[model samples]
Target: MPALAVFTATAATGTMRPTIATAVAIVLAATSGIAVLWSTRVGAGVGPDRAALGVLAVACAMGAVASGVQAARIHTLAAHPLTELTGGRTGVQLLVTGFDRPIRSGGVMVPVRVEVTGSGTSARAAQLDVVLLARDGWRGLPPGTRVETSVAVLEPRSAGDPPALRALTAPRVTGLPGWTGRAPAAVRERLRQVSGRALKGEAVGLLPSFVLGDEGRIASETREEFRAAGLSHLAAVSGANTTYVVGAVLLAAAAVRVGRRGRIVVAGLALAGFVAVVGPEPAVLRAAGTGAIGLAALGAHRTGRPLAALAAVVLLIALLDPTTATGAGFVLSVSATAALVLVARPVAQRIRRPWMPGPVADALAVCIVAHVATLPVLVASGLGSGPWALPANIAVAPAVPLVTVLGTSAAALGPVWESGAVVLAAACSPALWWLDTVAGVVAGLPGSPAVTPG
Candidate 1:
C-alpha cells in the first residue's frame, strides 16, 4: 500500500519518467504482495484483519499489473527515435513541443519533438527539448510549427549539470523540409496590435516579450540587469503576473457590483486570457494550476493554503515531467509559493504596527512571503543572501500589482489606442523605475551571504 501510494502520487504529479519509476514501483509492489500471500497461506494467524490484509494483497497485485502495463506504454513512447534525439548532432527537423520561463533564467527555453525522415527512414520523437536564448530579433515559433533548422542535438550528460545547457551540446530538429509554419494569424495579429499600442521608442521592442513571451526586442543589457538584480521574474510568465491580472479583473468586477459568482467567472476568463497571451509554458502552467486551486478555495469560502496547493501542483507537474524533478525553477517556484502561504502571514502579523495601514500590511506580507520562500535558493545559487531582501521586497511589492495590471492593460491597448497606451505606460513608469532601483540597490550590497558552500 505504501509503495502504491508513492507510485500513484508520483504519476499524478507528472514529474517523473513514468515508465522507469512506475516499473520499479510495480515490481516492488508485486514482490510485497507475493510475500504477504505466502505468509497468509503458511500458518500465520489469519484473523479477520488478516483476511482483509489478504484481500488488500490481491488488490495490490492487480494494481501492480495495471502499473506494469502503463509503464510498458511509457517505455514505448520514450523509445521513439525522434524523442531520443539529443547530443549536439546536426541536420534534423522537429515540431516545437513545449517551453518554459524561469525567473532566474534570462530567456525562454523551447522543447521540440521531432519526426525525422532521412534516407527514406522515418522516426518520431517526443519532447526533444532545446533552449532558445532571447535575442534582439528573435521570435518564438508556435507549437506544432515545423521548423527546419541545423541544430546540434545533445543528450542528458550529468545530474549536476543544468538541463538547458546540456540540451545545447546535443540538439534535434522537428518538422524539417516542411516548416510547420508560423503561429496562427489571429495570435500574431493580436500580438502586433498589442505591441504597437503599448510600446514606443525604447519600450516598443520589449512589448512583444512583455505581453506574449516573445523576447525579440528586449536589449541584452536590460536582461542582464534584471538577472543581476534578482528581478528577472518580472519578465517571465509566472504566477505573479497571472495572479495580478486575475486580481485586477476581480477588483474591476467588484467595483461594478459583480457578485461572488460573477467575480469568479470574470477571474476565470481573465486567467484563461493570460495563459493564452503567455503561450502556456510549463512554469506558467504550474502557476496557473496553483492559481486555479486558490480560486477554488476562495469560491468555497475555505482558507486557501497556498503551500498545500503548491505541493499538489508540484506533485502533479512532477508526475507529468519527472525530468523537471531536477530543474531549479521547479524548486524555486514551489518554494516561493510555500513561502507566500506559510511564512507571510506570521511575519506580517509580527511586524504589523498600530500605525500601519491595511495596504502597507498587505504589501509587507507579500514581500515577507516571497522573500522568505526564495531565500534558500537565492543563497544556494551564490546570488548573495542579503538580509535586506525582505525590506527591499516590501518596498517593491506594493508596485508589482500596479505594474502588472497597468502594463498589461497598456500593452493590450497599445494597438487599439496608442495614446491611451502611452498614458498607461507613463503611469507605470514610476513603478518600473522604483522596482529597478530597489533591485539595483539590494544587489549592490557588499558581503552578502551565499546559500551554497563556496
Candidate 2:
C-alpha cells in the first residue's frame, strides 16, 4: 500500500519514470494474483473444477478492480490544480503543514496547504505547496503551527542551481515569502526550557534529539559528524530507535518478574508515550504501527507477517492523510523495517562461511538484506549506486545498537541526573568519533552519489 502511495504520488507529478513504474506495479500485482490461483489448483491435486475456477476468477477480478480504483484516485488527486501551480507568480494563503530543521541552504523551508484567497476568488479548495523563506524572524515557527504568507510560487528547480529555486512542488515546498503566525505560547516556553537544558553538553544535546526528536540543540559539528558516518538515523525517531527504547523498558519490567500480561500492558503504555514524545509525524506513526503489529505477533507466538502489517499500516495512514502518499521519508521508513523483518534472516542463513564467526555472519546477513531491499530506492533517488553500501553498513551496524540504547537512556535521564548524563556522553564520544570517520571516508570515496532532484 505504501509503495502504491509512492507510485500514485509520482504519477500525479506527471513524471514519466514514476508513471511507468506505477504501470509496472499494477501489471505485476495482476500477474501475481493469477499465479497464486494457478499454483493452488495445480498443487492441491484438484482439477480446476467449475466452482473453483469461478472462485479464482472472481478473486482475480476483484484484485484488479481494487488496483484500478486506487490508481484512479491517485491520478485524480495528482491532477488537482494545486499540485501544478509550481513555476509562476501567484498569491496564496497557506496553512502551514510542517517545518524541517534548516539545511545547508542557510534557511528553513516549510510545507503548507494553500487555498487561493486572493483576487482569483473562485472559492475553490486546492492544496498549494508553499515555502516560507526563514531569514531572521521566520526561524521560529514549529511544526503543526499555521503560517499565513504572501509569496511567489515557482517551479521545481534542480539541486545544482544557484540559490536553488525555493518554490513549491507536489511533495516538498521550495520558495515563498515571509510568514506570520501567533504560535502557542506554552509550546514555545516548553521548547525554550528543553533547549536550554540540552545546551549544557554533548549528552544533553543528544538527549533532546532522542527523547523529543528535537535536534536543534545538537552542535552543528556533531550533527555533521553523525551524517558523515551514516549514523544520523539514530537521531531520528525511527523504528530501530523506538525498538531499542521499548526493549529496554520491557527487559526492566521482566527482570522484576512482571507477568506476560503485565509486560504487554507496560509495553503498550511505553509505546504510546514514545509516540507522543516523538511527535505524530508520518514516519514515527508508521514505525509505531509496525512495532505494535510485531509485538502482537510475538505475544501470539505467530511467525509474524511483516509485509501484511506494513500494508495495513500504509492503508490506515493513507486513508487518514492522503498527502503522506507523497512523502519520501514515509516510503523509506516502511521499506527499511520491512527489509529488516522479511529479508534479514534468509540472507544471514545463506552467508555461512568457514572464516566468519557466528556474530559476524549475522551482521553481514542483515546488512546484505537491508541494502538489497533499499537498493532500488537508493538508485531511484540518485544516491550512490555502488554495492559498497552493504559492507559499510555491516562495519557500522554493531555500533548502532549501542549508540541508540545509551543515547536514549541519556536523553530520558538527563533531566534528573546530570552526572549520569555526563558519563553517557563520555561513553558516546568514542562511538561518535568512529561514526564520523566512517561516514567521511565512505562519502569521500570516488563515485559516491549525492542527493539529486527527483
Candidate 3:
C-alpha cells in the first residue's frame, strides 16, 4: 500500500518490510525445490501423470516463494524525504517509470527516482516519489529513462490528492533507456502502424487491443458495444489470451523437432516477449506467471494441472504485488480462469450433441464457464449484463484464437516486414469483421434486461 509503481518485468518500486519474510521465503523455496527433485524419482508408486503433477505443484510453490523474496527486497525508505519540502521548490533528477498516473494536461504522474541535485541532500536515489510531470514529452518517457528538472513539492490538498512534484521549469531528458525499453515500444508501435494500414475502421483499434492489450485506440462507443455484448474482456489482454499465445508458440517450437529443454527455452523466451509486448498489467502479469510455470514444467519434461498453476500464479502475483491481491481485475481474471479449468471439459462433454464437433463443444463450454464466472464481477460495477451476453460470446468465441494467434504473428512480423505483417494480418479480417458485427447486433437486440448483483 506504500507508494508503488509496478513494472512489466520482474520488478516493482515500493516500500515494504523485509528481512524475516525474505528469509522465510528462501527457506520455503529451497524446500519446494527439493520436493520438485524428489517428485522426479521413480518407484514412488505414484502414476507418471500424478508424479508430474506433483513436480509441477512443487515448482510453482518454489516460483512463488522466489517472488516473495524479490518483493521483500523492495526496501522501504526510512524517512519521508519530502515532508519538509512541501510548498517549496527543489532540484531533482527523476525517471518516468510508468503511466501510473495521468495528468490533466496530457502529462502523467511518473514515479520519480529521486537523485538529489539540490541543497537538500537527504534524499536517496534508491527511493521513489510519486510526482506530477506536466511537461511536454514527459509522458512518453518509457521505463528506465531519466528526467531532470526543478520541481515545486506540493502537499496533498485533499485525501485523493497524491503528493505532486509539479515541474517548476521545462524538464529535460538527461538519459535514455537501451533495448530494455526501446524494443518493446518499437514492436508495439510497429504493430499499431501495421494495424492502422492493414485493418479498417474498428478493427484497426481492436486488433492491437486484442493481440497486445493496448486499448488506447478503441473508441468509447466501440468499448460500450463490446461491454453490452459481454465481450469487454476481449478488449484488454486476459489470462486466456496470454495462455493461448504461449500455447501457440509452444506448438510452433515443437513443430521443428525442438527437444524438451530447447522447447522450454523457446516457450520461456516467447512468454517473456509476449509479456513485454502486452505491457505488464495485473491480469497479464498473473497469466504470465502461470504461463512461465507451464513452460518451466515443459522444460522439466513434466506436466502440471492448470488449476494448480492458476492457484500458484495467483499466489505468486499477490506476493509480488500485494496491492493487487484484492483488485477487481485480479479477482475477475482468476474467477474466469478457474471456471474454465474446473468445468470447461466436463461441461463440454455434457453439452456435445451427436452432430456437434468435440472442439466446438469444448470451445462453447469454455465460453459458458468464463461468462458465468465473470458475470457477477461485470454487473457488480453496474455494467448491467443479460442473457444476450452468452450467445454474443458464443458468436465471437471462435474468432478469438484466430485473432490472437494471427494477430500476434502479424505484430511480430510488423517490425521486420511491414508488407509481410499486413499480409499476415489480412487473415484476421474475417474474425475482426465478425467481432464488430456481433457486438453491433447484440448491442441492438431487444430485451437485454439489466442483472444486478444481489
Per-model TM-score, in order, reads 0.71, 0.67, 0.66
Task: Give candidate 2 regions above 4 Å deviation.
Answer: 1-85, 115-135, 156-235, 293-305, 317-328, 345-368, 385-388, 409-427, 445-454
Tens-digit lDDT string for candidate 2 (319-406): 4444454355566666666776665556666887888786667656655665676667655764424434565676777666566666
lDDT of 2 at 209: 59
Q: Give one digit per residue, the lDDT tens place, for model 1 in 101-167.
A: 3222444455655445222354333444445433221234456556554444444444212223222
Model 1 misplaced regions, further than 4 Å: 1-23, 27-88, 97-109, 117-119, 122-127, 132-140, 157-215, 294-301, 304-312, 377-388, 448-454
Candidate 2 CA-lDDT value: 0.54
Quick one: best TM-score, which candidate? 1
What TM-score does prediction 2 earn?
0.67
Clashes of 1: 42
Task: After the best TM-score superposition of candidate 3, give how far the Cα of residue 176 lies from its true spot, in angstroms.
Answer: 1.1
Q: Would you give me the overall lDDT of model 3?
A: 0.65
Alpha carbon deviation, residue 391, candidate 3 (Å): 3.3
